[model samples]
Target chain A: MEPIKNDILDYLKDNSFMDTNIGLEDNDSLTQNGIMDSIGLLELMDYICEKYAIEVPEDMLTPENFDSLQGITNLIVKLVK
Target chain B: MSRIVCKKCVLDSDMPGIDINEESGLCHFCETYVPFSAQEKSDYLEKMEELFREYGGRGNYDVVFALSGGKDSSYTLHKLKNEYPFLKVLAVQFDNGFISDNAVENAKKMCELTGSDYFKLTMENEVLYETFRKAAESRDAFPRLAKYRASDICNTCISIIKQKLIEEAIVQDAPFIMFAFTPGQSPNPIIPLKANFIRWSRSIFEKQLQKIGVEDKDEKFLIKNEVIESMGKEGPRMLHPLCLWDYNEGQILESLVEIGWNPPDLNDSNSTNCTLNSFACQNHLEKYGIHPYAFDIAGIVRSGDMSREEGLEKLHQALSQPLIEEAAKKLNCR
Candidate 1:
């Protein structure tokens, strides 16, 4: 609850890979860094959809929107606004 | 030994942390049921249509088919080429040493018949086989399911396939990677856009080598994906058209056979694409007391695609005592 960005990143890292001891920066690229696999990516997407109640259009699931924590957080902010 | 499974579906108590409520005779996953009609679903179809429109004709190859020469992948190739003729499809296969003779032949026939571009990457799974044997020997956990879907072995194969597909797509500058996973076999809409999937795969392989008292210096083979942050960044998107469509397996099989596929053997294996699946399923069951593919079969039952009896039959086909032993013997782990 402290920072929505951190919350998102933390949840992602923790749930995925089970290798979450390492810290993730806000701008870190989760996909590029291999923090999660494809399954993990979908889980995060589903989580975002469920948590925010915003339906993510498949067209919008591009790397530009989901490649990094900052990019995803921005999308979340825009949607929940 | 008889297994206690969900009365509503196929999930068994063997899966990690799975519990069946005896009173209802349903597992928690089945009990917590909320089904949505097609109308309320997300804009998945509209987006898929848009993608098909945008990229189906835009590139030298718009999509890479993760073709295993099975009915599903073959059907996917057939549908894409015949229904959407403009899209150039690249059929990518990983020859994991044990691909069935029929599959190999049918794939060749498919290419000739369809005139589609084909590329096969061969990786001998000698080391992979060793890891599986070693895991079973050491009593280390073979990868099991958190949510029932692909059995551990199939999931491992899928991860490798996804990594290779993404790598090939990136290199070719292709816009999309296509795979044929029906409702039962798909991952949970999650994909690990492996930083360097080979690295991830190698780590697991290395563990197996260490078990066999062998060391393979195969690091030069690992591929790392480069993401140029400044460019208009787009990676390969997974397109599973089959998951969206309702298909009758028998009819699809008939269509595939007409197109040169051999009718499957009496086994009628769920994982007909890969020969290594039985070994993988055996590993999961031997170590975890659960069928690796139970979740997938159960999901199929839940979807009304297959009757509960049919799901059980598929599970029995792969996880039977004789079949499990046969797979392990082939891997030399038995």
Candidate 2:
């Protein structure tokens, strides 16, 4: 989870112009807190698919699955398993 | 830096990725933009049909159409109803106190003509106007960025529309929310990402909102959180239908006129709905010295609907004091 979270945090900062100074927490609600938006979700989905070599089942593109680093990590771990 | 306007279009140096080739007088965005091939367009239409088939009738309202009573949205509703009749659609229009009378009536008439359920969600104008005033008055960086994105008045109105559409999607169990934003309405596809930008904008707006007497609960509506926690990941997906299909304003207006939809009498030549559009547009122009609709107009030019000269004429509008005054009266921003 830490490695995945770290990679995602870096990706957000590098790719999306997310402010690294704010310091995203593992439990921070990215979308709910307005740190990300619809386009952000699309970018993240694309990144996760390429990074993990797993297509996020369309049904799993829900809020709970990608709400935070923690939730996204869980979804990725489950999909990889 | 001295601002360089695009030779072919209205885009200026302020626009991201805008590189004016000294020889050609065009920017890279315009030079590199290629309209979809016929085969690609056909494939996209087929995919849209597939989406409609899969999502149609899955809920009480299978889709929620964000209706602005503009030609694009009206045409989208028309085509969807005529072409994909099986889908249950709910048209939602947000009243931002500046929506033209004809637009409001047109929205109602379109719903009646198409036999679709319509919801007119009206916002508290006091708060709306105060926010608009702040948008007009505030020169702070984040607030200014908010203005630069959607104009001062439009940002507040659009925030309400966004909140309402998502809620309607959830409440009606609509699996998809359809927007009629054409490729023309999109940005450069590489505009600066608004990371923590909404939160910052919301905070600035909220300060004005509280001063204008809105409750805390209402403030939450302005926050865009659905991408995270609002619907628990099962929220309806926003679908831009026009991006999949070929459309030009002229064709859409002609089709709509045939079906009894008249363009609104408005100040903005490009706008056929909101009365305050020109006001916000002029404000942005005054502040940024760049047309807010540069991308939209450039998109239209790239898509071959209108000549770049025509687009420039529309963007570099001569001053219309009477119209601005009237729109200001409507918004009470003056």
Candidate 3:
């Protein structure tokens, strides 16, 4: 796994109710699969801010960027870049 | 009557007034799985933080928080105090006459630990019981079906507390009012509090009050004149920080524990506070054929904080509480 994927996994593990089988290639329907809810999404935004030192714009918390591990990883990459 | 099942899920037409597509059998609520775009959520959070900071961070003491001492409210109080230390949190508790000792303790502990000023309001049990009995007798006691399943008496208590909070805020020159409502409960974007909105809400209740033989003049006390007078002076904006942060039960528990907060074990079976909750759920289920907590618990389960089996168990326990039996008699459900 890449370093960023590891970070995502670690963050999920620290939070609650994330799948134990989460991986880079795992299914990304977090909301559909019950891995997270609306509030959970907000918490993830906070985590990203504290972890990557990225100021997540409020507009970035939609389903497009947070649907899966890959999506979140993409978001982090963009912010870090 | 023909049954209407969601083509996407098992939700049936008999569920409520929900309509399903004839071709797909999917209802609008079910069809819209993904609610927000990632960008919208991020922008909303950032905007919320900026608003809080611009309103004075901890410097401006312009609002009162309605702290129920539940998980959501506790979490909200924690964030409000942490982010805006100077904000005066007026923790108000409406003793419905049967609040659990643990709930009372939690309310007291939250105030003591935070050093926020606190107040308790209790209504006469007989009067509350009489009002609730009358409201339950009337089918339309509470016209807003989306927000609450509480008895008419419970509704009366909530109205009284809400009015009191607004009055106290205005008298104290506070500019905002806050509650712990989640997105599914109250989804309006965070904005400046308006007194006209308060008046409109009061009018809604005034109609209901008249139906139950409550005089219009009596409703005036339910909403104070001073609060109405100060509406244009920039009343407090109602904030829900819990909506701003991503929250899961585990994360909330851990964070609260770290801050010296504790959850009541009884909440595991029924509720954290409000002895009447189990009864309330029972009343809703008996009348509506579904638990009022169904939507909230389903949301949580769908979000992965709890298992479906666990949700069912909680539902069953809530239905089986002795309070339900007592409430049944009181509401003439039997």
Candidate 4:
């Protein structure tokens, strides 16, 4: 597992409704699985940007870039490069 | 078998994620809570002023205000118009089919008083009524924390309001959409509606509606994908000014009265607009053993705007049975 993905998973556990007991897959839909709502997603975006010190471009705000651990890690990794 | 209530707020051991310490008697939230410092409040106020200064007069309408005809929203609308008289506002009142006649009149009156254009947004009565009915009947239709903010029915209504209001703001090319949510309801003073975030939020609401068994997922209840595509990286920003300023209910009501804003005659202490609120709260409590307003009122008490006793009083206040029955009949839930 990528370190960024681990960080995001930890953040979800700390801040979101993501159940600690449930093992989240890389591609699981955050909203579909009830782990993240609209507000939760916003907070996640703010966290990712602040932690990585990379501003997410508006064009990159798609579900493919943010709806899962894999997608978020990829977006962060690409932006942090 | 015994209930353990928090000493700081109205939350108890009954609610999820609320653990009352044996020694402290404070809930986990209160135990780790930090109030906004004066400096932080000043910064937020300064940021809001800067936002208003930059975007107040550029768009077709400077602000798209959500007017529930409640005291908080009415007072906020009054204050914003007075503070930024140059702003062109389109105040939208989403008629959820359960709004009181008094609420409708109050909405119109506030718009008149504030010199803002009034728009009453409505959908088909049957569809709206069925949506509320489904909201009441569905279990776990929303996330647990979301349920704490409002009942399933209210979550449904408010989500619809947000979706359609964003659509309205986008279609009108408005820069800001204002909600009168109190500090307890939502702590954020401003939420930028980034393009992808808008789509993500709309999709979540769509799933919630589907979970409630609404067969026809109306476009009126969700933002269209094309609307998102047409916009730039960011759309309208959402502003919750009530969180930035002081929130004394007595002072707010007194000020509103001075401005000819009459209070509604409903028996529900927690709501000033919708008659379906009591039924929604009752349904949520029946289904989940939680009062939906407990989280909101608890946040207020935690903020020191209201005391622990006052919070509990508001939490356990007698609901309007007549109003609930009327709503239940309208929705055929009885």
Best by lDDT: 4
lDDT of 2: 0.68
User: Stretches of candidate 2 above 4 Å error?
Assistant: A1-81, B1-8, B14-17, B31-35, B140-149, B187-216, B223-232, B330-332
Q: Which stretch of 10 consecutive residues in model 1 chain B shows the poorest summed lDDT?
A: B139-148
lDDT of 1 by residue, B78-123 (tens): 8767767767778887776557777777776777677778888777
lDDT by candidate, in order shown: 0.63, 0.68, 0.59, 0.86
Candidate 4 per-residue lDDT over residues B156-225, each given as its tens digit: 9999999988988998899999999887887477788888778778878888999999754448788877
Q: Which regions of candidate 1 deviate over 4 angstroms?
A: A2-37, A53-81, B1-7, B22-24, B33-36, B40-43, B125-128, B131-147, B187-222, B225-232, B266-268, B318-330
Superposed on the true interface residues, model 1 gives a C-alpha RMSD in angstroms of: 8.3
Order of candidate numbers by DockQ, starting with the best: 4, 1, 2, 3
Q: lDDT by residue for model 3 over B1-334, one digit each (tens)?
A: 6986454433356654355778766755455554445576678667766765666434234557777777777777777677667666677776666566766777778888777877776767766665655655555454323323234445555666677777666666565677776543434345444555455445555655666666647443366665577556355665655555665766776887787776765533545666666666555555555445544554444434456566556645634456666655655555
Ranked by TM-score, the better of candidates 1 and 3 is 1
Better of 1 and 4 by TM-score: 4
Model 3 interface RMSD, in angstroms?
14.2
Best by TM-score: 4
TM-scores, all models, native as reference: 0.73, 0.74, 0.67, 0.94
DockQ (C-alpha) of model 4? Answer: 0.52
TM-score of chain B of each: 0.80, 0.82, 0.80, 0.97
DockQ of 2: 0.09
- For model 4, name the residue pairs that clash: none
Q: What DockQ values do the models have?
A: 0.12, 0.09, 0.02, 0.52
TM-score of candidate 2 relative to the true fold: 0.74
State the fnat of model 2. 0.00
